[model samples]
Target chain A: MNQSMVKVFDIQKDDFISAGEASSSVKKILKQLGVSPEVIKRAVISMYEAEMNAVIHGGGGKGYAEFFKEHIEIIIEDNGPGIENIELAMQEGYSTAPGNIREMGFGAGMGLPNIKKHSDQLEIKSEVGKGTTLKITINF
Target chain B: MEEFINSVTLDKDKCKGCTNCIKTCPTEAIRVRNGKAYIIKERCIDCGECIRVCPHHAKKAVADKLEMIGNYQKAIALPAPSFYGQFPSEYSRKKLLIALKNIGFDGVFEVAAGAELVSAETEKRLQTENFKKPMISSACPAVVRLIQMRFPGLIDNILKLESPMQISAVMARKLFSEKFGISENELGIFFISPCAAKVTAVKSPIGIKKSAVNGVIPISEIYGLVHESLKNTEDDNQTNIFSSDIGVGWAGSGGESNALSSGKTLAVDGIQNIIKVFEQIENDKIENVVFIEALSCPEGCLGGPLAVENRYVAKSRLKQHMEEAKSEKAQIKPVLSKAITWSEPIFPSSVLKLDDDVMIALGKIEQIEKIEKDLPGLDCGACGAPNCKALAEDIVRGIAKETDCVFKLRERVRQLASEMIELESELPHTMNRTEKNEN
Candidate 1:
C-alpha cells in the first residue's frame, strides 16, 4: 500500500529565466494528486525561494520532490559556495548576494527566511566551501 | 430551461474530425473520438476556442433567439459594454440602444453603467489591506472558471463582486418592474454577449446562486435587426446611456484596469497569455501589482469569437464610442450605486485529478510517466489526443489503448509478425517430419 511519486529537476547557476521551473512542475503534480490548494501554494513559494537562492548564491543545484500520502518532501541541493552562517542568512534583509545580482530585483535576502516561513519542517546542512543541501517537508 | 453543460457545441455533420480543437483548448477539454470531436462537460470553460478554431464551421455557441422574447410581457436588453464596438462610430451609442429597443426589447439597460458601479466598488476594495496581493479581476466568466479549474488556490484572490452582466440584470429587473408596475417574473431580462462564455455564465453560474438574466443573445445573432432599426429610431432621452466614458472603455483590454484610475494594475488578455500570468501568480513571482485585469479573448471582448467586426477596426470604433460615451449623470437609481457581491463562494473542480484516493492516483501517475517514456514525444495529435502525454493519461484512465499511438501500433504489429514467424518453426512433429528427420 505504498503511495509515493518523485520528480527531479536540474537547476543551472544564474539561470534566472528558468528559476521557478521546479516549483511550477511540482504545483501541477500536486494539483493532479488532489493535494489541497493551500498546501500547493506553500510548497510553491518555499521551493521557488530555494531555487532562486540556489541560482543566485549557490552556483548550481538540483531539486527533488517526493510526494507521500500524508506529507510531501522537497530537497534543493547546490554545489556552489555554501552559507557560512545559517542564523545570519535566515534573518530578513541580510543578503550575501553581490551588488550586480541585487540590481536584477532578486537577492533581497528573503530567500531562506521566506522558505522557512512557508514550510512546516525545514532542515539545512551546509559545508562552507563545498555546498548547501536543504530538506523541506510540508504536511498534507 | 434546458440545462446545457456548455454554451459551445458541435455540429457533428460539419466536423472533419481534425485535431484543431483538441490542440487549441486551454483546458484540454476536447477530444476526438470515433471520427468526431466532443467536448468534456465539466472542463469546458465555454471560452469558444473551439468555435474560433473549427475549420468546417462546426462549432457554434448555443444562444437565445430573439423569438423567445415573445414569451414575456416585458423584455429588456442588457447590452454588454463591448456591444458598442460592434458598429461604426457614426452610430451614437444612444441611437444603437434605441435600435436595440426597437427590435423587440421593451427597454434597454447599459451593462457599462453597472461596470462603473463595479469599478467604484473595486476601487474601495483595493484600499483595504485585507485583500490578497495582485487581486485578479473576476469580470470575465471564462477567467473565473479558469481559476476554479486550474488555479484553485487563487480563488480567494479573485475579486468577490458579481460581473457587470449580473449586476446590470439585477438592476434592470428591479428598475423595470418598479417603473412599469409589472411583476419581476413577467420581465424577461436578456444579455447581449460578445462571446459564448457569458451565455454559460448565465445558465450555470459559478459563485452566485443563480443569474438574474433569463436569456443571452450573441451580438451576431441580433446585429442585423438592430442595424435596420437604427435608421428610423428616434432619441429616447438624454438619460439613454448611463455609463460614464471610462465604463464604456471596458470593451477592450486594459479597460477595467484603466477604470481603476490608480494603483499598480496589470492587464493580460487572451486565454494562453492568461495561463502564463496565472502560473507566475501561483509562484508568487509577480511583484507589487495590486490588481490584474485578465480577459479570455485576444484584445478583450472586441476579439470575442462571436463578435462580427474585425477586432482592430472595432477597436478604433471603440475609442470613438469612448469619446462620445456619455459623461452625464444618470437620473434613475436602483442598486446602481454600488456593486453587489456574489451570494456563494466558488469551490475547486477535481476533474483533472487521476483518482480520488491519493495512493491510487499516485499509482496512476507512475503509470502515466512510464507510458509517456515509451511514447515518441511528437505531440502530433494523430492519436486523437492533444499530445503523447495526454494519450498516456487517457490510457492510464482506461479510456484509451497503447495502440492508439500510431508508432506504438506499428511496433505492436512488428512484434506480432515476428511471433508468427517463430510459430511457423514450431509446427508439430507429424506436420514437420522432413524437418525433424534432417535435425
Candidate 2:
C-alpha cells in the first residue's frame, strides 16, 4: 500500500451543475482515510471555495488532491485572467466575478477569503492576463 | 457490541433476482448472487426502499404479531401520529385511541404527546446547547443510520434526543404501570410504527444501550385490528381533542421544522434529497442555517413504506383533521427535559470505508480507480453490483470476480477463442489448414 493517494478533477467553465464534484470526491476519500470530521469539513469548505473560484472567475481549471499521513494538500490552477492585485483580492467581499454570476447567488466576493479562512495554509500565484495557481493545505 | 438487527427481509421464494431492488436502494445494500437477492446487514438502513420497489412483493418488514400483545399482563399501545391519518377524518383522535384499547390493549399512548415533549426540549437546546450549526433531526431512524453509514462526519450534528417513539414508550410504561398496578416489564410497550426502521431502532438502538420499547408493530399491520375495534367506540362521548397540537404535525414533511422557533430552519425529505443536503452541509455550502430536519421517507412518516394510506390522501386527511382540531387549545403537556434527552451519543460508522487501515484503503482506492477506468462504465447492473464503480470496489474487496461483469466476461471469452484459433493454426503441418492448402 502506498503511503499517499492522489486524485485529480477537471473543472469545466461555468458548469454550475457539477460545481461541487471535486470537493465531494475529495471529501469521500478523506472519509475513507478515517480523517476526523472537523478536518474533513475544513478541507471540503476550502476545496469547494477554491474550486468555485476556478469555475466562476478562472474559466475552469484543474484541481489536484494529495492525501498524506499528516496532512492533505490541494492545488488548483486556472488559465483565466489572473488577479493583478493579490492583497485586495484577499479581502473579504472582494470579488471580480461578473454581475451575472453574482445575480446567480454566487460571486459574493467571499470565495478567496473564505478559502483562506478554512485552510491552515494558503498560497496563491498569479500574473495579470495569464492565470492563477492556488495551493491549500489542511492538516489532518 | 450492538447486535445486527434489520427489519427488512427477502422472501426467497418470491424473489426473481431480477436486479430491481438493487438499483433502487439508496445505500446500495442489496446484491444478487445465485439467482437470489440479499441485503448486506451492516449497510442496510431499513429505509424500505427495496420493499417499495420489489415487483414480486418479495421484500417484507418484520414486526411483532398482534397476538404478541396477549403475552403480557397489561399492554399499552403507542400509536405513531401517522396512524391517525390512516383512519377517516370523521373519527376523532381520541376515538381512534380508545379503539386501540378495545383491541385488547389495557391502555393507549399518543406518540404525538411525546413528540410535544421533544419539540419543547429541542427549542430549549437550540437556545442553550453549544452545537455545530444545522443540527440534523434524529426523528427518522432511517436518516440516523444513513448518516452513520454515508455521512459519518455529520454524526455530531444529530440532535441528541430520544425519538417520539422511545419517549412515548417510556412515558407509556410509567403511566400504564401506575394505572394498572403492575411492573413496567409486566406491561408490554409496543410502538405502532409507520416504517421498518423503528423496529430495527428498538432492537439495536444508537445513542442508547437499549430501547425502552418492548416491541414494534407497523401501522399497516395494526390497521385492520384497530379498524375492526373502532365500531364499538362512541366518538361523541370522548374527551375534547386538540386539533391544534404541534406534535401531531410531525407526521408529514417539514413538521419538525415548523414546530420550532429556530431561525433559518430547513426541512428536507426523501432519501436522495437528504443525501444531497448532507453533502452540501458537509461542504459548508449550506451556511447560516441553525437547524435541519431530514426525513428518509417522502412526505415524512405519512409516506413510510409500511404506511397504509397513500401519502397524498393521508396528507390532505391529516391537514383537515388538524384544522378541525385547531378549534381546541392544548391538552398534551411537555415532559421533564431530562426525560427526553438521549442516554448516550451516536458514533460514526466505519462500514463504508474500503479498509480499516488508511494505507490499505488508499491502495484499494488506487486499484478501484484503475479497474473503473477499464470497466464498460455502462452501470448496467448485469454484474449484480449497483454500478461499474461498485463492481470495481467489490472486485478489489475480493467479494466478487471481475468476470461477474458480462462485458468483461465476453471480452475474456473472445480473447480465449482467438488464442485457440491461433493455436490451431500453429498445429503440426500435417494437421494444419495452411499445410493442406499448400499441398
Candidate 3:
C-alpha cells in the first residue's frame, strides 16, 4: 500500500500533563483522514496504551505514526530502563511501576496487554541496559 | 430530496456575527460566514446551546403559534413535565392543568403520564431482552441526533422507544377523538415543549414515519398566558388531575433513571458532559452501566433554552411539586401499545464525512494539516470560522483561502517584504543605478 503521511512527536518522560497528547493528535488526524471509526478507535487505543507505557516506564520516548492505504503503523521508542522479563511484563495486572506512580491511578500493568489486544500486529523489543521499542499496527 | 427543516434558526437582523454561538455549539454546526451566523442544517441537532449563549438573542426556536390550534375543531395540550416547573410551588398542579383549558385547549394530557408509561416499558425491556449493556435513552431528540451525527457506532445501543411527547400525543389524540365523537383529523394534539429539539422532533421525526403531535408550542412563549390564567381561576372545580410524583420527576436530570427501578443507570446532563460519557461508552470503558439517560440541556429539560425559570429554581419547584403529589404511585399504568414503540429503524446521519473516497479524504486531511501548521493556533474565531482547525478544513474544502487567516496574512506580508528587498538586490547593474538615481 502507498504511504499517505508520517507524523512524529518527541515525548518527554514522566510528563503526565502531556502524556496522551501525541496519541490524541494522531486520533484527530485519522478522524480528519476519514478512516473508519472502528479502525480509528483501535489505532487510538493501541497508540494511547503504548504512549502511556513509554511515559510511565520508558524514561522519555518518541512516537512515530505512519498512515498508509491499508493500515496505520505506530512506533514508540524510549531510553528508559529496559524490561528484564518480557513475558511477565506482557501479563495483565503485572506491574513493575513504583508505588508513587501506582498512586496516580495508572500502572495497573494492563498497558502492553491492552495495546496487544487492540492492535492487529504488535512487536516489542528491549535490551536490559538499553531502551525499549514498541511497534503497533492497526489495519483498516 | 426533502428540504431539511431545523427548529433553531438565526435571525439575521439580530445577529451581530459574534462567535459566542459558534463556540457554544456542541456539534460545531454554526459558522459565521459573510458577517452572519449560519447554521448548517444537516449538522445541527437543534440542541439550543447556541440559542442559550447568543448575546444578541439572534438564535430563535421556531414552533407553531397558539393560533395554529384554532384550525382544528378541538385541541388537546400535551404538556411536558418541564412545563410544570415554570410555575411556583404555591400553584397546584390541578390549577396548571386547568390553565391549559383556559388557554383554548379543549383538553389537557400530561406528558408525564406518558413518561411513567415509558419508564415502566423501558424497565420491562431491560429485564426481558438480552440486548446491549447500556441502553441509551431516546427521550432527548438532540442527544439521539448527536449519536447519529457523531457516535454512529453506538446506534444499536439506543432504546427503540417513542419519546413521552410522541406517546402522549398519540394517546391524547386517540382519547380526545373518542370522547368528543370527533374524527382524529378534527382533534389537534399539541406538545408544550421545553426545548427547540422537541419542535424539530414533531416536525421531522427521526425514526417514525409521521409525528402524532399536530404542533409544538414552546414553554416560554405561553408562560405569560398560563400565569394569567392561573391568577384568574377563582375555584378549583375545573381542575383535572394527572400524573404521579414519579411522572413529574421526569422534568429534572436523573428523573428518568430514577423512575427506572432496574440495573445501574447513568444520567448525564449538558451537551459537553454527555459527549464525554458517550466517548467513554464508545471506548467500552463502561461495561456495567445498564442504561444511560443523556440530556443535551443542562439539568435536563428544566435547563432548556425556552424554559422561563432558572434551571436550579425549576428543579427545586419540580421536586416540591413531586413531593406534593397526592398519589405516590403512578396514576396511569403502562399499556402494551404499538404506538409507544419505534416504527422504523433509526439510521446514522453520516455528517462527518470529509470526502466520498477514502483516498481523496486522506489527501484533504493532509492539506488541512499543512494549512493548520501555518495557522497561529489561537482559535480566536477571527477568520469567521470556529477555530484554526475549522478554518483549515474550510480552506481544504475551498470555502476559504490561506490569506484569510490573519496571522498567515501577516506572515505573507513579511515574506513579501523580504522578497521585494531580494528583488531589489538582484536587479541588473544599469537598473539598480537608475533606481538609485531616482531615489
Candidate 1, which CAPRI tier? Answer: medium
Q: Give a tens-digit lDDT track for model 2, residues A31-91.
A: 8778778888899999999999999999999999998877999999999999999999989
Candidate 1 similarity to native, TM-score: 0.96
- Give Cα distance to truth, residue B249, candidate 3, Å: 1.5
Candidate 1's C-alpha runs over 4 A off are A1-3, B1-4, B425-439
Candidate 1 local lDDT, B1-439, one digit each (tens): 2244688999999999999999999998888999999888888898888898888999999989989889999999999888888887888888888888989888999998888888999999999888887889999989998998899999999998999889999899988898789999999999998989998888888778899999999899998998899879788663366777877889899999998857699999999999999998888888889999999999999899888888888889989988866555554654666898888868888888888888888888888999999999999998898999899999998988999999999999999999999999888868987877888
Encode model 2's per-residue lDDT on B274-391: one tens digit a residue.
9999998888778678889998889999999889999989988888767765666655343334446677877877777787777787888899889999999999988998899989
Sorted on DockQ, best first, the list reads 1, 2, 3
Clashes of 2: 1
Q: Pick the candidate with the highest TM-score.
A: 1
Task: Give the per-residue lDDT of model 3 (tens digit) for A83-126.
Answer: 89989988999998889998887787888888889999999999
Which residue pairs collide, candidate 2? B243-B325
Please identify which of the two predictions, 1 or 2, would achieve the higher TM-score against the true structure.
1
- The numbered model that scores best in DockQ is 1
* Count of clashing pairs, candidate 3: 1
What residue runs in model 2 are displaced by over 4 Å at the alpha carbon?
A1-3, B236-244, B329-339, B426-439
- Classify candidate 2 by CAPRI docking class: medium
Please say which candidate is ahead in DockQ: 1 or 3. 1
